[model samples]
Target: MKRIGVFICWCGSNIAGTVDIDKVAAAAGTMNGVVYVDQNKYTCSEIGQAMIKDAIKEYKLDRVVIAACSPRMHENTFRKTVESAGLNPYYLEIANIREQCSWVHKDKEAGTAKAISLIRTAVAKAAMNEALFAVEMPITRRALVIGGGIAGIQAALDIADTGFEVDLVEREPSLGGRMAQLDKTFPTLDCSACILTPKMVDVAQHEKIRLFTYAEVEKVEGYLGNFTVTIRHRARSVDLQKCTGCGECLAKCPAKVASEFEEGLVQRRAIYTPFPQAVPNKPAIDRAHCRFFTTGKCKVCQKVCPADAIDYEMEDRLLTNGYGAIVVATGFDTHKLNDYGEYAYGKHPDVLTSLEFERLLNASGPTGGKILRPSDGKAPKTVAFIQCVGSRDKAKGNSYCAKICCMYTAKHAILLSEKVPGSKAFVFYIDVRTAGKDYEEFYTRAYEECGASYIKGNVSKVFPEGEKLLVRGVDVLSGALVELLVDMVVLAVSVDARADAKELAKKLAVTVNEHKFFTEAHPKLRPVDTQTAGIFLAGVCQGPKDIPETVAQASAAAVKVAAIFSKQSLLSNPTVAEVEQKLCSGDMSCMAVCPYGAISEQVVEERRGREMVTRKIARVNVALCQGCGACTVACRPGAINLKGFTNQQILAEVDAICL
Candidate 1:
C-alpha cells in the first residue's frame, strides 16, 4: 500500500476561519494508506515546506496532498519543494480549499465538508502519480515577416540589425503597403513615403534580408522553431533581371485599367508599376486586362521593350523555404464604404473613401498633389470626413474599435486645412478615441491649431447636389440638427480582417477571436504569443495598431523568438496523467470524449491469449495531455483514471475524513 500524507493549510484564517481545519485533518488521518494528516498556518511558506519534508521523512510518504490554495497558484511551489527533497515532484497534488471552498462557501459545516472532500481527491490522485519532463526542440535563428507595411518593415529591420536573417514578403508589385498609399501620417505630420520608402530601400539592400515583392505566402505549415512556408511568385510578365525599370513598356501598352494603387482615380497600362518609386524597380502586368491574355494577339509590350524583359510564357513559380519563427504582420483592409447607403458613397461621384482622398492629396497621385473634387476638377472649399463608418456597430458585426481612425481622421482634418489654405473641414465621430501616448495631444493640436471643426455625432445621410455632397446629421452634444454642403466626403472606414485570415488560422490550428484576429495567450501578459507554441502575431493582423505600438509589439515578438532560439530544448510540465494498460478494458468511450486528443486506442492481447477481438482501451499521449481529468469520469467500466488522481486513493481519503 502507498503511504500518503495530507497537509491542510489554515492560510492565516483565509481557510480556517470558514473551514474547520482540524475536522478535515482528523478525517484524512483515518483513511486507508494515509500515514499522516497535518494542518499548517501556510503550506506554501518555507516553514510549512519544512513541515511537509519532515512529515515525508518520518512517515515514509510516497504521495503528498496539500489542502490550500488553487493548484494554479501553489502547485509549482510545492512540486519544487518535493523535487528538492529528492522526491518525484509529480507525486504531489493540491486541494483548492482557499478559492474553491472556504472563500466561496459561507457556512462552516459545508465549507469543512467540501475541504475534506477536496483533500481526499488530491490524496487519491497523488497516490498514483508518475514523474514527467519537457521535450526541447531546436529553434531556427531566422524569422519570416509576412507584410511589407510599416509594421512589417520595422520588424524586418530590427531583426536584421540583431544579426538574424529575415525573409520579407509582400503581395503587391511594390514594397510599401497601405501606409504608402497615404499622403501624410497623423499628428506629427510627416510625409508617409518620405518617412517609409527609405526603410523600404533599406530592406531591399539589407544583406540579412531577402525581399520578395509581387509574391504571396501560399501556405504555412509545421510548428515554431521549424516552419515551412510556400511562397507563390505571381507572373510579373517581365524579366526582372534584364529590365532596368525603364518607363518604355509602360508607355507603349494599349490596354488601360483603373489603377487601384491610385484608388481608381487614374488609368494604368496593362504592364505597369505600382508607383514611380517602387522598390526592386520591377513592373507587373495585369493578366486580366492584357489583350494578349484574352486573344493571344498582342505582343506590343515585348516589341516596345528595348531589353527583352516581357515573357508571355512565364508561369507562376512556387518556392518553399524553412523559417525558425514567423511574424504574421498581414495587416488589415479598410471596409468598403459602399455598404452604407446613407453615405451615398458609390452613387455620388463626389463621395470618396478615405483612401481615395489620400491619393488625391499625394504629389504623385492622379491630380499631381492637388486635392481636386472628382466631379469638377476644382479645389474643394469644404470637406467632411465621417469617422467609424463601419466600426463599433453590432449590426455591422464589427464591435471592437478599429483603433487608428480617430487619429487618421484628425490628421485628415489638419491636411485639408493645409491643402486648401482657407477651406473648412468637419469631422463627424461617435466618440473621439485617442488612447496612445502623445496621441491625445495630436488630436488636440488638430482642433486648436489646425482650425478643423470636430462634431460629436454620426452622419445620418448624404445626398448629391450637382457637384457637392449634402451631409445631414445631428450633433449629439448640442442636440441640434446640422447640415453641410461639402465638395468631397471622406469615409474613415473600419479595418476588417484580411479575407484569408480565417483560412490561414484554420491551417495553423490557432484560435481566432470574434473579430477574426488571432487570439493571444493572454490580453496583457502574453500579447505577442498565440495559443499555439512557437507562433507569434504582430501588427494589424492581430488587431488595428499604429506605427509606434505595432513596432513595439513586433519587437516584443522578435525578442520572444530570439529567446526560444537561445534555448537548447523546450521544457514542459510533466505532471500529466497516464493509463495503466493492465487494468484498462477495451472501452472506446473515453477515447471519443477526450478534448485534447491525448487518449487513443491501441491493440493489446489479454493474459489468456484467446485471440479474441477486444475494444483495446485508450492510452494517453503524455506530451500532449493537459491533464484535465475528463477521461477519468468518461470511463464506464472504471478503467480510465488519472495516474496521480485515482479512485482508490480518493475513496480511502474520503473514508478516513468522514470517520
Candidate 2:
C-alpha cells in the first residue's frame, strides 16, 4: 500500500469560514493509505510548501493529496514541490475543496462532509499513482502569425526583432484591418492612419519577416515546437513584382463596387487597393465584380497598366510551412444590426453605424471630410449619437460592453464641433465608462468645452422624419420623456468576435468561449496564451480591448514565442494517451476522434495458436498527444488510456467517493 499524505488548506478563511477544517482533517487521517494528515492556512505559500517537503521525507510519503483550489490554478506549483521532495510530480492529486465544497455550501456540516469526501477520493487516486517521465522534442525556431492587423503586425515585428524568422498571413489584400478604417484615436485624437501605416511599412521591410497578404491558414497540424501549417494564397490577379502602383489600372477600370475600407460610403474600381497607403501599395482584381473575370470580355486593366503587370490567369496556390509557435490576432467584426430595425438602420440613408460615420469624418472620405448626410449632398448641423447600440442588451445583441465605445463616442462628439463650426452633438448613453488613464478628462472635455450634450438614456426608436431623423427615448436619470430632431443619427454599434473565429479555432485545435472569442489558458495568468500549446491569442479575437491593450498582449505573445525558440528542446507533457497493443482490435476509432492526430495504425506480428499473423493496431505518438482522453472514451475495447487517469485509478476514486 502507498503511504499517502493529506494536507487540507484553510485558504485564509476562504475555506475555513464555511467548512470545518478540523473535522475534514480528522476524516482524512482515518482514510485508507493516508498515513499522515495536516492543515495549512495557505497551502500554496513557500512556508506551506516547506512543510509538505519535510513531511514527505519524515513520513516517507510516496503520494500526496492536497485539499485546496483547482488544479488548473496551482497544480504545477504543487507538482514541483512534490518533485523537489524526491517524488514523481504525478504522485500529487489536488482536491478542489474551496471552489467545489466550501465556496458552494454555506452549511458547515455539509461543507466539511463534502471536503472529507473529496480528500478521500484524492487519497484513493494518489495510492494508485505511478511515476511518469517527459520526453524532449526539438524546436523549429520559427513562428507564424495569423491576421495582418495591428496585433499581428506588432507581434511579427517583435518576434522578428528578437532575431527569429516570422511568417505573417493576412486574409485581406492589405495589411490594415479595422484600425485603418478609423480616422482618429481616442484621448490624443491622433490620426489613426499616420501612426498605423508606419508599423505596416516596417512589417513589409523587416528582413526576418515574410508578409503574405490575400492569404489564409487552410490547415494546421502537429504539436508545440513543431507545427505544420498550410496557407492558401488567394490570387491577386496582378503581378506583385511588376506592378508599380501607378494607379493607372484603378482609374481606368470601368466596373465600380462599394469600397469596403470606406465602409461602403463611396464606389471604388473593381481592381484597386483597400486604401492608398496600403502596405503592398498594389491593386488586386476583384474577380467577383471584375468585368474581365465575370463577363470574360474586357481586359481594360491589362491594356492600361503602365508596367503590363495585370494577370488574367492567376490562380490560388497552397503552401505549407513549419512553425515553432502560432499567434492569432484576427481582431473583431462590428455588429451587422440586422435585428436592430427599430433604429431605422438600412432604411434611412441618414442613419449610420459608428464605422460608417468614421469614414465620413476622414479627409479622404467620399465627401472630402464633410459630415454630409447620405440622403442629400449637405452637411448635418445636428447629429445624435447612440451608445451601446447592440451591446449590454441580452435581447438585442452581445451581453458584454464594447470597451472602446464610450470614449470614442465622446471623441466623435468633440470632432463634430471642431470639423463643422456651430454644429451641435448629442450623445445618449446608459453609463459613461472612462476607466483608462486620462479617459475621464477627455470625456469631460466633450460636454464641457466642445458644446456637446450628454443624455442619459437609451434611444427607444429612430424614425425618418422627412429629410431628418426623429429620436425618441426616456431619460432614465430624469424619469421624463426625451425627444430630439436631428439631421442624422449615428449608432455606436458593438463589436463581436470575427464571424469566422470559431472556424479558425477548430483548425488550430484551440478552444473559444460562449461569445465565440478565443479562450485564454488562464484569464489572470495566461491571458495571451490559448489552451493549445504553442498557440497564443491577441487583440479582440480573445475579447474586446483597446489598441494599447491589444499591442501589449501581442508583445507578450511574442515573448512566449521567443521563449520557445530560445530553448533547444521542450519537455513533452508526461501524461499522454497510451494503448495496450495486446488487446488492440485495430478498429481505428481512436484515430477518428483524436483532434491532435496523435493516434495512428501500426502493423504488429502476433502469435495466435502457433500461427504468426500480422495485425494492425492503434499507436499513439506521444509528441502530438495533449492528454485530452477523448480516445480512451471512444475505444470500445477499452485498450486506450490516458497515463495519469487510467481505468483502475478512476474506478478507485469512484469507489472511495461512494464510501
Candidate 3:
C-alpha cells in the first residue's frame, strides 16, 4: 500500500469558521493508506508548505491529500511544494474545503462531515496517482494581439519593443479605437487624438510590429507556444500600394452612407477612410453601399483616380501565421439603450448616448466642435448629462458599474461649459464613484469651477417641449422633485463585453464571466492570464475600466507575452488523454466532438495468429488536447483516458465518496 499523508487547511477562518479542522485531520489519520495527518493555518503559505515538506520527509509519504481550496487555485503551488521534497508532482490531490465545503455549508457538523468525505475521496484518488512527464515544444517567438483598440495598440507596441515580432489585428479601418472618437480625455482633459495618434503611428512604423487594419482573427488553433492564427483581411477596393491618399476617388464617388467614425451623424463617400488620422490612411470601398457594387454601373472612382488604384474585383484574402502567444485585447461595446425608454435615447435627435456625445465634441464631428443641438444646429445654454444610463440597473441595465461614466460625464460637463459660454450642465446620478488618482479632485472641479450642478438621483422622465428637453428627477438628499429644461440630453452609457465576446472566447478556448467578459485565471494573482496558457486578456474585454487602467492592463499583458517568448520552450500539460489501443475498437467517435482537432485515426500493426495485421485506432495529439476529458466520455469502449484522472482512479474516488 502507498504511504499517504493528509493535510487540512484552516484557511484562516475561511474554512475553519465552519469546519472543525482538528476533527477532520484526526479522522483522516484513521483512513486507509494515510500514515500521517496534519493541519495548517494556511496550507499554501511558506511556513505551511514547510510544515508539509517536513512531515513528508519525516513520514516518508508517497501520496498526499490536501483539504483546502479548489485545485484550480493552488494545485500547481502544492505540486511544486511536493516536488521540492523529491516526490512526483502528480502524487497529490486537493479536496476543496473552502469554496465547496465550508464556504457553501454553514452548519459546522454537516460541513465537517462533508469535508471528511471530500478528503477521503481525495485520499483514495491520491493513492492511485501516477507520475507524469510534460512534453516540451519549441516556441514560435511571434505574438498576436487581437483588436485594434487602445488596449490592442498598447500591447502590440510593448511586445514589439521587447524585440518579439507582433501581429496587431483590428476589424476596423483605423488604429484608434473608441479613444480616437473623443475630443479630450478626462481628469487631465488632454487632447485624445494627441495622445493616441502618436501610438498609432508608432505601431505602424515599428519594424517588429505588423499592423492588420480592416482585418479579423478568423481562427486560432493549437496550444500555447504554438498557435496557428488565420486572419481575414477585408479587401480595400482602393489598392494600398498605388493610392496616394488623395481626395480624387472620394470626391467623384456618387455614393454615400452614414459615417461610422462620426457616430452616424453624417454621410461619408462610399470610397473613404474612417478618419483622416487612420493609421494606413487608405480608403476601403463600402461594398454594400458603393454605387458600382450595388448597381454595377458607376465607375467614377476608377475613372477619376490619378493613380488608377481602384480595384472593383478585389476580394477578401486570408493569411495564416504562427504565434507563440495570443493577447485578446478586443475592447468593449457601449451598451445599447433599447430598454432605456425613460432616457429617450433614440426618439429625440438632441438626445444621444455618451459615445455620440463624445463624437459631437470632437473637432471632426458633425457640428465641427460646436456645442450645438443636433435637432436645430443651434448652440444652447443648458445641457443635461444622465449617469449610469444602462449600468448598475438590475431591471434593465447591466448590474456592474460602467467604471468610466462618472469621470467622462464630468469631462462632458467641462467641455460643455468651455465650448458653449454660460452653458449650465446638470448631472443626475444614483451615486458618484471616482476611484482613480485625482479623479475626485477632477469631479470637484466640474461642479465647483465649471457651471455644473450635481444631483444625486435617477432621472425618471424626459419630455420634449418645443425645442427643449425637460428633465425630471428627484433630489434624494433634499427629498425634492427637480425639473430642468435643457437643450440636449446625454446618457452616460454602460460599457459591456463585445456582442461576439462569447464567440471569440470559444475560438480561444478561454472562459468568460456571466457578463460575457473574458475570465481571468485568478482575479488577484493572474489578472492578465486566462485559464488557457499563452492566451492573455487586456482592457475592457476583461471588464470595465478607464483609459489609464486599460493601458496599464495592456502593458501587463505585453509583459506576460514577452515572458512566454523569452522561454526557449514551453511544456504541454502532461495530464492529456491517452488511448489504450487494446481497448479501442477502431471507433472514431472521439474525433467528432473535439473542439481542438487533436484526435485522429492511426493504423497500427498487431500480430494475429501467425501473420501480422494492420488495424485502425484513435490517437491523441497531446500538444493539442487540452485535457478536457470529452474524448474519455465519448470513447464507447472505455479506451480513451486522461492521465491523473483515469477510470480506475475516478472509480476509487467515487467509491470513497459513496461510503
Pick the TM-score winner.
Answer: 1
Backbone clashes, each candidate: 9, 0, 0
- Per-residue alpha-carbon lDDT of model 2 for 180-230, expressed as tens digits? 988999999999999999999999999999999999999998888999999
lDDT of each: 0.82, 0.92, 0.91
Model 3 spans with C-alpha error above 4 angstroms: 1-131, 577-621, 624-642, 645-659
Worst 10 residues of 3 by lDDT: 591-600
TM-score, per-candidate, Cα-based: 0.82, 0.80, 0.78
Better of 1 and 2 by lDDT: 2
The alpha-carbon lDDT assigned to residue 97 of candidate 2 equals 95
The TM-score of candidate 3 is 0.78
lDDT of 1 by residue, 1-659 (tens): 88898888999999999999889888889765689888899888999999999988888888888999999998889988887776888788888999999999999999998888887767666766666555555567788888888778887888888888999889888888888898888768789889888989999999999998888888876666777889898888887888888888889999999997888889998888988888877788889999999778888989988899999889999999988877777788888665689999888878888888889889999998888988888989899999998899878637888889899888888888888898988999999999877889989988898888999999999998766889999999999999999888999888888878887776655667888887787898999987666677888889888878887888887787777667775554354556677767767677666644456678775656756554566677664465667777777667776655556756755764564
Clash pairs detected, candidate 2: none
Question: Alpha carbon lDDT of residue 113, candidate 1?
Answer: 89
Per-residue lDDT of 39 in model 1: 87
Candidate 2 regions off by >4 Å? 1-131, 581-621, 624-638, 649-659
